[model samples]
Target: MSEANTALSDERIKNTSRLRTALIRPELGGICGTIIVFALFLIFAGDSGMFNSQGVMNWSIVSAQFMIIAVGACMLMIAGEFDLSVGSMIGFAGMMIAIFTVTLEWPVWQAILVTFALCIAIGALSGYIVVRTGLPSFIVTLAFLFILRGFTIYLPQLIERRTIIGGIDDAAEGDWLAGLFGGKIFGGLFQWLGDNGIIATFERGTRAGDPVVDGIPMLIVWAIGLVIVGHFILVRTRFGNWIFAAGGDAQAARYTGVPVNRVKILMFMFTAFCATVFATCQVMEFGSAGADRGLLKEFEAIIAVVIGGALLTGGYGSVIGAALGALIFGVVQQGLFFAGVESSLFRVFLGLILLFAVILNTYIRRLITGER
Candidate 1:
């Protein structure tokens, strides 16, 4: 072939290969699933106010909750570890905040700070044990799951004679740090929209001409912020490469000068930090902390990470993919309620989707490894 023709042919071949690779990407499933879920919800729940501003906020908040925990779980999984203690950490952290602020009458900001420090320390301890003993992270964190849950229940009962702590709202009144987790943003913009008839407002009450959604909740903001930061750390920096290397092959990574132990331990601490963030938000929103709060949330976060296309083996994933998976969860959960379907079926959906995701991941892993 002539030089010009050969060059053109090569370009065409490259474009074709690129398309094929994109089609098989780990995020492909999450992207497709998100589209289908949204389409389905729009069709079935379109007229039910589920697409309205208020409805959008509902699902968005739920999705953000999932996104927050999933970010931490995603990074940890990418580093080849699991932290089953995440749910317990949430309850424990919230309880600690409540105990410090309410029972002990500490300032809300001080309580929040102390709770975060303690939770992160516990997470570091969990990581240290796993690294020193060479035990599976699953087992170590599972033990912590029970240990922390026990403390969550026992401490509240011992201190307040109950497993539920309240009065947080009163204590947090005018508290600056509490506002960061509990406050809303963009109030003026939402107010403008409401005045312009762009969004629904309270017709007649003590509060009239006010938007149903005053502003975006801080929970969603935290979720977006975490995703952005996590994505940057995972893809744009040297540490990001180290995470993949450590997960992909710890011994090889160590020989190559990757700080595998430190990376894994930091990931564990990060997971705990995320859990505390969730707990703080929840406590501020609800004005209470219960021992049973965050039950099974660890599994939900794992499912979100898995559905986002992170392999069970580790070293391959996308933060954006995980966020999409969380969005899918948030939509389907509220969509079912809006469509008037039984809410219990959400668990069934979780089971099915998890199975499908695992099968799909296995196929993708085999494809990458050329395994039979």
Candidate 2:
């Protein structure tokens, strides 16, 4: 009887392991999505510039914003918290930077420092409320989203009686910021792409094709660097283990001396820091971050993280997967444009993709938790 039981146990363990291997492989799903996207473009808009040089750069330039924010949101989600106010935070930080640098005539670095300090305070307050009250992060962050959003538009409008804030002095006018954040330097890379004879149609075969211009936007590089750093902290270090433990079972982690509250605080701070970085990028891209600079951006970040295979309930996710998910997102958006789909209708398509991603994520999640 004992021998028979041991054999059954071993069989079950093997099955469980196999299930995990599949569930954790979101990068595989990402590859499938890539193929699907590429094929759709080829069939529907084969004549579009998507196969060209400059057309490729368009998406890379646009996607840097989404990819960077998505990477940070992924880390926060994996740590078992959420930040709905990120979009508002962006506008607020940008507006504040303008106010300090332009309206108040402060130096750029000083304005940035103040903005960082403010973001940290807000993050700390949010974390304190969530951890102490045991309220849902959704509810707490939802309130913040509204408060910050209102302040962003109304405060400026109340003072100026207009929705826009212009006429401010350009405190730092040497074009240094733009050169660093918005320039391109991959002439050699684009030459390599065309020489490969892989595909060409869009861009008029324009020269700036490497899919990332200005020598790979500073923001994307920062996001990638963050991924490496976050991955290191999560896997090669002790803090990562604690994050998994805390998210997996808060009560148990506390009993194990995991410093759960401190972790929660730090996660919030990380998100706020990301918001500040996003604001800086927006300024570099547009020369200004308006009161309405980042509308619905927070939702987009959350969607990217979820699509990257993070669990809705927390405890499992991959930063690299989220980065890949962001790439898929950028491609689809640009693909629709290249394929001649109405730009206004792109959101509906995005909604469908998110739905599909979530469904896949949920099913895989069920298999892992033994609920399916």
Candidate 3:
């Protein structure tokens, strides 16, 4: 009898171990995808300068752009909400900044600050409508998507008589606040590397010996900073617990005094903040803003978040995984160009990956809930 009991106990332990492994399987999807992307790109584009300093910078910047938005989307999705207006918000914010500085002749810093405030307020309003009306966030944000995009195009044409605005760089010259978004970091380090023959340097002309890559852009910095802060909040705080609770089961969370409405609203505002950050960095880097900027970026952000292992039903995800998903996007998008592949194939890849992620997440959810 005692021997029989021991056998049963051992079997239960093994089953528990298997269950734990299954629980974590979905979260590893992003990490595995990132590794595979890097390996493939290295094999196909290794000799194409895709791994060089400048090439790395190119992909890194693109990844950072994705990462900035992914962070917000991940958090919001984990809280059981969607923000489809993010892409439109980016265009709207950039256009507003251009209009403020160039057309209105306002100070660059003032324009940027005001744009951020307006964007955040709009985000809050979106959240308010959702919480108060009990409408799905998807529908609510989708409405704002069109509304904001329309303004993005119409405002520029109405004021400047064109859809594209310029003169931002000139207006922002010597502006202290603009530097935070537009400036680069670690220039001396890169210069040293070039001087010591570490990185490629220009060999001819008045700029001879200058490093091919100068420094890290502020966009990358913002990406890393947001990721760190987001990860910390999601993994380490009472508020984080509330977020998960709010998304997992709003009714139950409210029973426990979780303030579900407040959490959701705040998350919407954060999503807007992230989108504006991307916009400011982009406009600064390009020295101009267009109505067409950030087209389809909202879907890209959602795809990245899904690839990062967040359940469509909400309450499960990792910020680190989302960052990895964004990295995969950056690599594959740039890798196609370097490998001489057609660019349009990227959309096909996105569709396939998103479908796979959704299927995997569904399976994981069933496992956790003991559903067939």
Relative to the true structure, candidate 3 has a C-alpha RMSD (angstroms) of: 3.1
For model 1, the superposed segments whose C-alpha errors exceed 4 Å read: 1-19
Scored against the true structure, residue 58 in model 3 reaches a CA lDDT of 94
Model 3 misplacement above 4 A: 1-14, 18-26
Q: Write one digit per residue (lDDT tens) for candidate 1, span 1-372.
A: 578776655544434466557746778879989999999988989999999999999999999999999999999999998999999999999999999988999999999999999999999999999988999999999999999999999999999999999999998989999999999999999999999999999999978889998999999999999999999999999999998887888999999899999999999999999999999999999999999999998999999999999987888887888888899998999999999999999999989999999898888777667589
- Using lDDT as the measure, name the better of candidate 1 and candidate 2: 1
Provide backbone clash counts, one per model.
Answer: 0, 7, 0
Q: How far is candidate 1 from the true structure (C-alpha RMSD, Å)?
A: 3.0
As for TM-score, the candidate ahead, 1 or 2, is 1
RMSD to the true structure for each prediction, in A, is: 3.0, 4.5, 3.1
- lDDT of model 2 at position 280: 72
Q: Cα miss at 327, model 1 (Å)?
A: 0.9
Kindly state the number of residue pairs that clash in model 3: 0
In model 3, the clashing pairs are none
